[model samples]
Target: MSKIYVLDTNVLLQDPYSIFSFEDNEVVIPAVVLEEVDSKKRYMDEIGRNARHVSRLIDGLRASGKLHEKIPLDNGGTIRIELNHRSFHELQDIFVEKTNDNRILAVAKNLHLEEETKEKGKRVILVSKDALVRVKADAIGLEAEDFLNDRVVEMDSLYTGFLEVYIPLDMLSRFYEKGELFLSDISKLPFYPNQFLIMKDVMGSSASAIGIVDKTKVKVKKMTFNQEHVWGIHPRNVQQTMAIELLLRKDIPLVTLIGKAGTGKTLLALAAGLMQTEDFHEYKKLLVARPIVPVGKDLGFLPGEKQEKLRPWMQPIFDNLEYLFNTKKPGELDAILAGMGSIEVEALTYIRGRSLPKQFIIIDEAQNLTKHEVKTIITRVGEDSKIVLMGDPEQIDHPYLDAYNNGLTYVVEKFKNEVVSGHVKLMKGERSGLARLAADLL
Candidate 1:
């Protein structure tokens, strides 16, 4: 049975090509959705880019046939610009407002009623990204769903970049003796490139070792910083140890760290960047940046010059740096950075359109970025540069991005098999006991 899906403006803005995702179904675009999209097309962000793309896509489709009627899609589905649904009396009695969401709901409700009266009644579904809109549709006896075409994977089943293997004591001994073990020696366990492994004894012994899968072999290795710490911070957990290894390794140019609050993802990245750029002189400079995503409220209307206005947004980065540099008072870290002349902190917005070379770049709070934003950041890395992306996927503030579809997880999944890339999911929080408890229970 063919279903008729009424798309909301957010669905179109989230994915410009979502009209073709429904195979053999009918896609209806309410005129209100187009109006809402038009209102957003003038902005200069990712949302605006998508809005413009959706408009151009619809315009290109007009060449084939009229959108107000029905235009056939290549995937055996049909799309139509639904302009006839101007008002619905049934919705006014329930919603009591003529908002865009209510208007969209009215169109879906009307279509659902009309389909129910047909000899072969077709299903009418409202597709939207907003939870309230979907809930309202359900209240009005209409089926509704979220736009899932862009979702990469579920949260529970997400890749964690590490696995545990219990093997015979002799195998562990051989691994420790030979310094490495091939996958064939370990029962052909599935392993991704640069994935960390905790090899334990299966014979009820207390023997355990940490290893990392680089090529086809797993090499037994310890943490990078033992005698000397990265700045003043030390690895308090195995996950942090693994993160430091990935961060300091010159072979892995791209590294990603996923964790919850207080998991030390950004701290470890910053520490490694400082070590590589300042102490080791492996890179020319240490560049730290993060996306300017608003959490509860936006900061556009603040009063200041650009740098002064960005102070609050970048305060978290400064806090981490202050802790690392042991800056006791305000402006202390600034003087130190000015004296070093090897550190630059900027926003991701202004970093675009520049080729950065010989720099250790760290992009914190990476979960708020989309796949395109991640691509833009990675493409800007010039020769002899390393980029570390750290974020808590569960703490996403972006309206359109989620744990599975955000740029952090996208890059983690995409680069799992590459040699030059490494990923680590920090399972333990080392910030403080209270913070760790809040991260888990709260």
Candidate 2:
């Protein structure tokens, strides 16, 4: 029997194409969801864009058949807008509020009761992205679940960009002597381009070496930039070394770095960008941008000009830059930035339609971005531009995204096979001892 999936407003807002995800099942959208989506359609953000997209999609579907009735979808499923069974009497005792969420729950509850009476094995599940909504649904004796179609990988098994492989002690010496090792001669497991390998001694010795899979994918080569310092910053750990290798490689246009707080993700990315832009003159400029997602309570309506208003949000970027520049005086870094005119720090909001060519773009805090938002940013890269997306997936601030489905993880999984992209997940925190302890324990 086909199940019934009643979607909440947040599900559609998170993904406009969620209606087509249920295969051969009935997708029912409460009328209140439309009202909720409509109220957010005018905002200039990702949610508004998704809300408008959902509205357009539902309107297009209506051309095929009446939405109030069963409208057949292309995936052998049916979608309908529930206009009836939204009476609050059924949920008045349980939920006294007549809010939109309550109305949606009432629709789902009525459908579930009706299905229970008529069909034998049919289930009505409320699909939402909100945790509180799921809890309320369970409180009212309804089956509720999160929308799991957007997740690219399980959080526990997320890609770390490197693997530990044991090899014979002789092979480790041979790799050192020859400066490269054929992957076929080592492990039989499949490896992606630019993935790091820690070749340990099979005899349980302390002898080990690090190598990265080359773009050819046939062999693992030594890291070219492992010994080089970028903007006076050196790699503190093996993961940072691998990240530096990818960051300095001009061939790899897309690089992603994932780690916890104080893992030097932003610091390393800024160092490489500065070195490539100011020292090597590889690119025309260094463009640093990040999504403006506030942590905890937001300080609404910052009072200042554009740059001043952006300072609070971009202070972290400036802190790393100051450390790299060793600026001791007030406004010294600002003077340098103004004198060079080659570095641009802006929010990801203004980067939508601009064509960035011959530039090194670093998008910090990328874990707060959605898949579509990241795609839009990547597609804006012009010729000779290398874009690096780095963030701690565990520290996401976006309401609808999680570690498994954020833009950073999504890009890491999707481009792991492509030769033009590389990824590294830094494990150790190098900011300070206390910071590391907090990251691990707290």
Candidate 3:
């Protein structure tokens, strides 16, 4: 059954090459989509870059045939520019003034009407990223869908990179004595190499655990984590296990974590960084920084000094600091922050000029960053410094970023499987109940 997909402005903006995503489905780009693309072609950010890319793509397609007419694609589908849509017909009933949303809906409505008259009754689906656009699509009698390509992997099934398994009591003894445990020996087990294991005795009476440090060892060595247990939180799942691997791993020079807002990406990295820097003195200092994209554009001038200007944007970081310091008093945390000259929490804007060394660097909210920005940050890591980039791709505030193209994704897709790097996708929401519910429902 062939379907007609209408590419909304946001869909194109979300992914310039989204037209190719439907496989062989016919794709229709309304003339209004081009208008929208033209307007954004001058943008300085990712959205602008994507808009320009769309323009180039449509232009290149013209070489095959006229865009105004249906052009056959090598994939067995056709793409055409929908120029027959009336600009403002019946729009007054829905919107007071001419708006982009209404304009897009108007195109979809006209397309749906045209489809209804066709003998085959083709499906006219409007693809967009804006929630309101999808709502308007439904209201105006057109099928709509959000661009899912940019979405992070499922919250529940996002790759944790490691897993835990429970084995029978006697199996533990045989493994301890033999030293090498074969995969066939644990075929029914949910274990993987480099995966942390908590081999608890199946019987409730015996409360014991052995970590699976090296799965290839074949000899089951008893795992131990008396050190990391000092903190109240333990590696409860595979994601945490991978996280522990990245933190304990001094060899991997780079690590990246992608998850939603409350997935404990930043918290775990920060805690491990503090442990390594303060407790073990492995690194000389801990450096934390994030881009300063104000909720909107930042005001040109500030009423107070540097710290005052940073207060609003840095509040989240401060909240983490306050919790870590266990302080409620005003200025007390700042005093501590100042005391530890080893710790630096500067803005990303200032990092351009320096080469950092022998430090555990953490860049938060990295999904809001671009590939170029990530490259700049990574290049600054000099000598023995290990950098951990963590952020929620779904919760990005940047206008230009989507999950596939954000700095986190760019780094992961580019660096995964490299010897000096490790990547973990945190699936479970370890935050409180309300936060997790909001993440799931909202």
Candidate 4:
């Protein structure tokens, strides 16, 4: 049955193309949503970008026909702007507020009542990304649902990029002897491109090997770089070892590292960037950037120059760099950073319209970015440049993003089958035993 999906402002802000997602259904945009989108269009962030996109999309649709009336979409669905301008007379007694959210709820309630009077089997559902709004809609006896078109995967089923398989000692020995084994000769388990494997010995000899799954073959891998250490940091666990291999690989240009707090995600990425830029000279420079998302509340404004104001937000990156440089004295790290002409540290705000060629780019706290933001970052990568995105999906500070829908997870899931990308989910925390226990238990 074709149902009416009345979208909230947050839905459109999250995804401008959401109107085309409901196949063969009627998509209704409350007039209030447009007002909210217009208010956000002035900012120069991801939300502002999406708001502008939505306005442009709606304007483009207006050329096809009057938006107040039904407009045919490229998909089988129909989209229309609801200009009912519903008053909160009925909801005023309970909601008791003239806020935009209340106005949106009034629109949904009016549509729900109108649909209930019809004879056809039509349903009116209020779609939003706000939890409180959905709860209020349900309290008012209206059907409410989340806009979940962008969730890449369920949290429990997210790809770990690695698996364990038991191979016989003879097969393992043959793998070691030949340095590679065809996938057809192994068990009938399927593997995505670049999927790591911990091959345990089935003969109970405590012998094990680590290898990456191939489309046609599997090659044994050793932790030579992890053992030797890169920029004074060694892989503390198997996942970290796997991460370094993916990071240092010249062929794989895109790498993603995900884990909880204290998992050494940022530290390892910094170490790899330093090794490739300073030691190996594989890249011309190293660029480290991250989204400047506040944890809870904004600090308003700080009085300083550009670098002074950004120091608080970029301090985490500097901490890792200082550790890598073994700098403890004040201004010592700043001197080293100034002396190193090949290193660049800046906010993601300044990355647009710049071409980064032959650079090792590391984006920390990438989970705070939207999929479109991540796309912009990836599309800016020039030839012969490597980009590493590291973040903990569970620790996202972005209001609209969650573990499944964040940009980091989106890239990890989308690029799992691609040959140029690799991912690793660090399981154990190497920061400290206390920190590891806190991450696991708390």
Kindly list the per-residue Cα lDDT of model 1 for residues 313-386, writing each as its tens digit.
Answer: 88898898899998898799888988999988889999889999999999999999998899999999999999
lDDT values for all models: 0.88, 0.93, 0.76, 0.88
The true-structure Cα RMSD of candidate 3 reads 4.9
Global lDDT of model 1: 0.88
lDDT tens readout by residue for model 2, 97-201:
898888899999998888879748589999999999999999999999999998999759887899999999999999999999999999899999999999999
Per-residue lDDT tens digits for candidate 3, residues 57-116, read: 989999999998988887888999988885676667777777777877787788788778
Error of 4 at 172 (Å): 1.8
Task: Work out how many backbone clashes candidate 4 has.
Answer: 0
TM-score of 2: 0.98
Native-referenced Cα lDDT, model 2: 0.93
Comparing candidate 3 with candidate 4, which one achieves the higher TM-score?
A: 4
Cα lDDT tens digits for candidate 4, 366-390: 9999998899999999999999998
Q: Ten-residue segment with the worst summed lDDT in candidate 4?
A: 215-224
User: TM-score per candidate, in order?
Assistant: 0.97, 0.98, 0.75, 0.95
- Superposing every Cα of model 4 onto the true structure, what RMSD results? 1.8
| Candidate maximizing TM-score | 2
